[model samples]
Each structure stands twice: as structure tokens, then as C-alpha cells.
Target: METRHLTYPDTPDAYPSVMVLGFFDGVHKGHQAVISHAKRVAAEHNLPVTVVTFDPHPKQVLSNKPDAVRYITPLSRKLKRIEALGVERCLVLTFTKELAGLSPQQFVDDYLIGAGAVHVTAGFDYSYGKFGEGTMETLPYHARDQFTTSIVTEQTRRGEKVSSTRIRKLLAEGQVDEAHELLGAPYVICGEVIHGDARGRTIGFPTANVLMDASYVMPRLGVYATRVKLQDGRTFYAMTNVGRRPTFYETGAVSVESHLFDFSEDLYGQVIEIEWIQFIRNERAFDGLDALVAQLKQDEVSARSILS
Candidate 1:
């Protein structure tokens, strides 16, 4: 897939490709549906499928706490998901202060049209430009005879709108099972494995310690059934904990540590991805090392059962 960091200065040579625009934070089912429609439309028109997304999400810029609302999928992961949908090109625009101030019509003329969009696809609630002034209401006037717009309806699963916000709430509350259903896949956290105290190793179950990206929302404090992917691309069934080491009296610093079932290898510094499948138990303070080890063994059993 072609990745372009586009701006008004450099416009596309082509003038009629299908475009899908959104924050696409998780590229969740709803976002995917819009992209799917755009891809199909693009295919029919024999045009390249392009997705326009912005970095440093608008919420981060406009909200009170720029740091508090942790995103589900960061830019790198978002791009990867978009590419997986077979999008021909991805335009990742830097969401600068000036860019955010553009009027609705200016955004359409200078960005959408300049980017060569002959057709556009967006979610029912998608909006653009300064103060979110651009809506489905404004597309026709600006594009004139050159553009066609399709608003993909909301996607639902189990009677709820499949949305990034809902998924984030589910993860925050540790509702892994429900979250997975909305996400249309397991909820995953990917990061680099780092050296910990090796306390789990001393106990019997060796674990790969992962340092999660601070900008991403984490699942609730609990043990979860998970699948871990190594940097070398090996995947393993694993039991993961997303919590402070309460059993060891550690607090404040939350961690993600996983014990790969039936496997062992040196993993320090390697990037690992763990998908949370089911919440097994809440984090607790064990009486001692032996007690902690015993509980972990039980966690392993529960995780294995769920995964199997």
C-alpha cells in the first residue's frame, strides 16, 4: 500500500479516486464498513482506493486533557489495519493547529478536491475542518459536479453500535468478551518486551514483560487469556496480566506480563503483541510468593481452557 504524508502544497496527479475519511482510530467495524464501501466504489470506477486520516487525533488537540483520552489504535497500528483492508493508498495528514482551523468549504476544496477525490465515503457522523463545521450537509455544494458522497450507516453488533468509544469503554471496564464482539476480533496490546524482576521465573512460570504504549487504552486490571505474537512472527497461546503486581505489593506502575504456554525463549527487547480474549480474574495481593505462584498456575489453567 502507498503511504503519503500529504498537504495542500502537494496535490495528487489523479483527480477522481474514491476517498474515505475518518479518524479511524481503531479501524473498527464501523470504520471498516466505510472503507469497504469506498473500496468497492473505487473498484467499480477503476480508481485507486484512498483513505484520508489525521494524526495527533483532533480530540487530542481540542479536548481538555490531551493526554487522558488514550486511543485504541495509534497511528502505526491504524495504518497497518487500513493497509490490511487492501486500500491502495493512505494519506496521513499532520493535524496541525492551522489545519484544524480551516473552514468546511476550504477543507473540501483544498484537501479533499486537491487530493483528487472524485467520490467520498464517510460514517454517518463523520465531520471535518474547524469546529467540525463540515458535515454530510456541505459536501455537494463544495464538490459541485466533481464529487459524489456516500455516508455509510452505523455498524452494529449484538444490538449496539460498533464504535471505538464503546470498545474503549469495554476495555476500561475489563469487559473483554463483550469488547471482542464489538471489535470483531480480540482486543490486543502490542509493545516491546522488557526485563522485569524475573519474579515469575523464580516462581516457575517465566513471563515476558511488556511495556505498553502510554497513549493506548489498556484493559482493566486483571488476568486474561491471550495470544502473543513475537517480533520474529511466532504466535503463542499465553496468559497475560494487565495490572500492577499487587501480589508483590507493587503499586501505581501497571504492567503487561505474559507466560507463553508450552513455550520459552529469550524475549527481552523483542516486540510482542498480546490479544486479550477473556478476563480470568482481578488482580489481588497474594499472601506470599508461593501463593502468587499457585494463583498463576490456576490462571494458566483457566486461560488454557478458554483458549482451547
Candidate 2:
């Protein structure tokens, strides 16, 4: 897909394309429905589908706290998901205070019309412009018959709406299996391996300490059954711990340590994706090294069963 980093107040794109608009944080099932409809509309009209998204999230800038916002799919992962859905182009607009201050008419003129929107598709609840005053309902009024609009309604499963907020809540509760159901895939966190205290090595369970990207919404502090995919594409079953090692040190630093079953290679500086399959157990301080070791052995057995 052709990706463009667009700045505001620039010249309108000459290419007439079908535009899909949203923050599209996780690109969850609801978001997927909207994009899929855009793809279909683009196919019918013989035009490219341009997905318009924002960076740093409007919430981070608009809210009082900048760091309070976390993402289910960071910009990189969101782009990847959009590309996989057969989008033709993606416009990453840098969200700033200036952009957020635009009026509803200004938003339509710049984003939809300016970006060459022949048709627009977004979710029912999708909103834009100052304080989200511009919504799917207002798009047609602002479009002035220049383009058609489509709004995909809420997507739900098992009588519950599938949403980023719901998924985040599930992850926060260490309910990875339920999160997986809402996401329509395994919940993934990709990161680079970094150095740790190397205490797990001394205890016969060497781990890769992953330093995750800053903006990801990490799963709750606990053990999980996961599959780790290395940079080169090899996959392994893993028992991952997200906790402070209280057995070794009192109120230790929180860490993400994954022990790859049947593999013991130094992975410092390498990137890997961890796909969480199930929540094994909550993190707790063990009696000692021996007790922790025994629990780890059980964790491995549980992880192997779940990952299998």
C-alpha cells in the first residue's frame, strides 16, 4: 500500500479515491467492518481506498494528561492491519492542537474533500472535528453532494459490542482469551529483547526480557500462555511472566520475561512478537526460589497444553 504522511492546509490530492476515516486504534471488528465496506465501495467505483488516521491519538493531545492514552494497536501495527485488509493507501495525519481546533466544515473540506474523497465510509459512532462535534450524521451535510457516505453500525458478538475499550478492559483483567475473541485474533505485543538481572538463568529458566513500545496497553500483571514469534519467523510455545520478582527481591521492578520452551538462545537486541493465548494465573510472591521453581514448572505444563 502507498503510505503518505500528510500535513494540514496542503493542496488537495488530485487522486479521487474512496476515503475511510477513523482513529482506528485497534482496528477491531467494528473498525474492520467499516474498512471492508470502504474496500467494497472502492472496488465498485474503480477507485483506490485511502484510510485516513491520526498519530499520537487526538485524546492524548486533547486531554489534560498526555501519557494517559494507550493504544491497543500502535500506529505501526494499525497500519499493518489496514494493509492486510487490502487498502490501497494510508494517510497518517499528525494530530496536533491546531488540527483539533478545526470546525466541522473545515474538517470535511480538508480531510474528505482535500484528500480526494469520492466516497466516505466510517463506523456509526465515528466522529471528527472540534471536540468530536462532527459525526457520521454530519458527514453528508458537510459533503455537499460532492461524495457519498456509508456508516457501518456497531459490530457485536455474543450480545456484547466489540470495541477497543472492551478489549482493553479484558486485557487489564488478564482475560486474554476473551480479548482474543473480541480482537478476532491473538492479542499481540511486539518488542525488543533487553538485558535483565539474569536471575532466571541461574534458576534454570532463562528468559528474554522484552522492552515493549511505550504506547501499548499491556496485559495485566500475571502469567500467560503465549506463543513467541522471532524476527526470522520461528514460533515457540512460551510461559510469560509480567510481574515484579518478589521471590528474589522485595517489591522488585515489573518486567516481561518469557521462557521459550525447548529453546535457549541469547536473544539480546532482537525483536519478537508475543501472541497471548490464555491467562494462566495471577502474579504473587512465592515463599522462595524453590517454590517459584515449582510454580514455573506447572506454568510450563499449563502453557504447553493451552498453546497446543
Query: TM-scores for all candidates?
Result: 0.96, 0.97
lDDT of 1 by residue, 11-128 (tens): 5555468999899987888888899899889989899888889888777877788888688888898888899989988888888777888888888877788777889889988888
> Per-residue lDDT of 257-279 in model 2, one digit per residue for the tens?
99999998889999999999999
Judge candidate 1 at residue 170 and give its lDDT: 94
Residue pairs of candidate 2 with colliding backbone atoms: none
Best by lDDT: 2
For all the candidates, what are their Cα RMSDs to the real structure? 1.5, 1.2
